[model samples]
Target: MKKMIFVLVYAITTLTIFSFGKAAENEQLSIALSGQYARKMTDASKKLEELDTAVKKTLLFNESDGSSKAREDIWRLSSDIKNSVSSLPLDQSFSTSWMNYLGRLGNYAKEADRVTDHNEYLRVMGQASKNLRAMADEWEVATTGMVSGKLAISDWTNRLDATKSGHDWSGMGTTVKQYTESDFPLTASESDSMKKKELRNMPDSEVTREEAVERFKKLFPSVSNEIIGVETSKSGSPYPFYHIRFAENQSIGYIDILEKGGHVLSFLSERPFGKEVLPFEDIQKKAEKFLADAEYKDLVYEEARENNTAWHMVYVRVEPRYGAKVFSDTIHLKVAKDIGSIVGLDASEYIRKENTHPQPITKKDWKKFFHANVQVVKEELAYVENERLEQRLVHYLTVTIDEHGVIGTYAVIIDTETSEVIKTERLQ
Candidate 1:
């Protein structure tokens, strides 16, 4: 216990020193990202440990049904690692290959569904879990490098982002390719095909490739001339898109435009965002204008977060007549804080055909649903999805509850049709 206490104090002391020491004094270095690096390292370590444990359990299980929980844990942890790895200032050369590895791990977790050879699955997953541990260690070293300023600042931050390589997972081929056909990652080929199947009912392609290019140019007129090439997606894929690539003037990225509606399905622009950044309000305005320019309508935001170089935000579409927010139909945006440029966008959720929900037969009384001591602070109508992906109108409640002595605020969703508390999420 004494040793544990001493180690905890030492870790905290080291972090404080790093935050206020010579590294913080460096003009070109970012203290926020340096601090964030420590967090990402810790997260990676925990996730890798969980993933390895889950993989070990799966290898011992006699039947696939018996290992369902462990398999889900493997997939979830791999996804968590993939997201954490994305925040780092990854070297461009290693980013693609690393993502490919993470993706294959997720597919391997579900290989039982396809009746893949159990021996091969056991071998590949065991090795993959070990690889994750090593990767986590390397990331920990990189985090230290960031805080110590031992490596040249330009080496990590020269290009703003080394991530966001897009759907071109051609080079992310894995050694375990022969073990399972679903070895492709979630962001790569397999998930795309699956998602496309889910969205198979989307309107047919009527917009020409030339028209898609014009749309892309209009959305980012400044870098339109920098566009080098545009390629078409697979015919078998649902909602075929034109993958447009652009580079030059520090902006190297791609935009995927649907061939049917010329809608900007998704886009990612990678470039340096130096130490200076605009205020959050300005960033919000910039993102709003870009969405407006894209002709997206009736979107409203409730929160935004700063993610080092960019501000991540989600806006839900509201039904004009009912004023109920449709949580299923949403748009996610990422705006670079440096110049408020729309660096990333994903409107795939919005593009899906609207699912109808049963209209509220009657509004439920909040007082009856809550405990006597609970105080309702706010309430609104919302359309939330159920376990089966079916939509249902619900009473979105924000309330304060005092338990013994402590008070907590929570957001509760009550199904209007049955007056049952379906979900409860702590807001603070």
Candidate 2:
């Protein structure tokens, strides 16, 4: 009788524990299904709807006619869409497809930022917008039903599977190719091609590390005097540079200087700013003074915009003889809004087009070279750079034409003497 009682007690204890464990699991799952996770799903669906609408608007506006602000908005919306898609709770099969699509969309938006063509932008945006709208509609239906207790998460799972089966996502690969082709250090083949095709021989910078250190000191007079460290490396590029670390306001600051020329390529500071004290005009003056001190003279600011933290600017070299803008010789810089100090300088593009002297005819010849296809509205003399870093003297004509009831603006680059079309790019 004692052995039978012990066996019965063990059985009862095991059953009780098992039943409690099952109940706790059910409760936790109930919380997950109804609370934060469910709300996140709904939010994600709404963001998708916003993205679809944004893309539709972008499709309607030709890139050539859209303002810079419009392009910025589109870029921001594309980023939001990518983030929303990433937050979705999809299984492996669907997640992979959706991520690939989002990757393409992000890349398309990035490329569109740099002189996007009208027909190309329209084509890409149309397809992507249509697909996204369809996905958003489906997501809304599933999310609404799930929240109302009419649909299960598993039902959404089946819909995702169906979506994946319907779309052929194999052609949509990652954006690795676009990254490789953009402005970056050249590969072996690319370098060889560039060397073979270059109009002028590329010069090498041979400045010593000590000279670079002094240059950095001169560039940032406000920084602490003591240098923490100095190192040099090829940086996997054709050029070598010195990476210098210094102290600024008890914070670690750094700068990269080209080894050949002792030019400050970039700089960074960990110090945070409290408020903006100097106006934009003052900031521009400071930047001009700094550039003048560094011997980068006669620069024309091609573009300037202010963000939350700094003034982003693009300065181009001007041809002194002809008084024309040499757009190929460009430098990018940023002025911190709070301190009105130079925070960044990128002269890589200028360095790439070394010794590019374009010999062009008089400005009056511009009208003679204008093609019959495009009605030239405005013409200016500017040095244009091609893909292989080759510079051409061209009559840059900003022209407008009607394309299937849509008006489009384009920059037509006509060769100086030959009157042949060098290239054409859309102007946003």
Candidate 3:
């Protein structure tokens, strides 16, 4: 009887030990998976940021000065990013939202090469980027917590398929308030005409295709020998240019230069910008110098905005005669805040309208056009396009006016040609 009892006791003990060991092994496996999931989510978030940058490039360059290959690449990258998202462990809601967003993004990107007045696509892309950034932050926090033993891996995994009840889906910005799939800003066919619109900007000087390629080589010596293609710009394009491409060491680069002056309209390389080490002023100076060397000395810095790890500066042509800002003759330069490198340049507008001259309107002359009851507070020269799509020189006036019982500040644009009030926009 004593031997039988000992055998029973030993069997029970062994079984308990085996079960505990199995549970521990499963826990470790779950933790490893959670880490991998977080990493992929971070990667997807990064791809989305790249997509946002491509969209901004489209906005800045478009058909007027952008390359067809660049537009095509945007489509390709979005597709690749969508595939990346699919590899993530998402539930019905998350997967459905992302898929829908990527599908619409790919469709919009197909015909977004042209310049147009409508910018609904860009606005929507900005919202999507914001949501992706938030998701990445949340994942990072969860991963850090789990690895440090502050969180349970099992708990994190559960949320992959099921979000907590009462969470707002609209905050994700990819779905409607009710989480329906049909609430995208742009319909499939709405931007079709915009995609087909053609914009042309004539360059200040004309150069041969050979000369354009040589100019690009000088700008990027490291890849000069790797030139593979130099295609001509299509008809309806404002300036004649050579679309040059270089492929080396598994990386590719692209540049568009005028066939006349050999001026570069745009440039892009596949290399990543490194860490941010320099201040904004230092980076801005570098960009300014780049524009100066490129023969854009007459342009004045208007504003600088940052996105996708780069600072993009918008420069406007200063009217040589009137001291007015020719906003229509613009240029865009992108400085990689990381490593303080000038990574992009778009001078299509400056090339097209650099010689534009605006008539002068003195301070006293502007008063003759002001409304009788309006009080002028500030004034500046501005080049604006009218409703008729005609570029005009105007005085951008800030004024105070009483509208119905409310005092408001307004911005009024007066056409310098006819001294007529063209438009008034509320400032406050």
Q: Candidate 3's residue-wise lDDT over 1-428, tens digit each?
A: 99999999999999999999999999889777777766666666666667666655665642434544545666787787678667765554556666666666666567553326445545554555555455546434433544445545566556544557233333443432222243245433333212222223332457887788778767666556788898998886745578988886644778898776676778876666566567888988888877776667788888898776788889988876777887667888777777666667777666556334446564555445566778989888887765434557788888998889999898888887677667889974
Candidate scoring better on lDDT of 1 and 2: 1
| Candidate 1 per-residue lDDT over residues 227-307, each given as its tens digit | 899899987765678999999698898998877777777888888888788998898888888888888878889668888
Residue-level lDDT tens digits of model 2 in 243-360? 8888766546788887766766677776676584679889898888888888888788787888888888899987776677778667888888887888777776565543445575
Output the better candidate (2/3) by TM-score.
Answer: 2
The backbone clash count of each candidate, in order, is 0, 2, 8
Candidate 1 total steric clashes: 0
What are the C-alpha RMSDs, in order, of all predicted structures? 15.1, 13.9, 17.2
| Comparison by lDDT, 2 against 3, better one | 2
TM-score of 3: 0.45
TM for candidate 2 is 0.49
Candidate 1 wrongly placed segments (more than 4 Å): 1-197, 403-407
Better of 1 and 3 by TM-score: 1
Per-model TM against the reference: 0.54, 0.49, 0.45
Cα error, residue 176 of model 1, in Å, equals: 23
TM-score of 1: 0.54
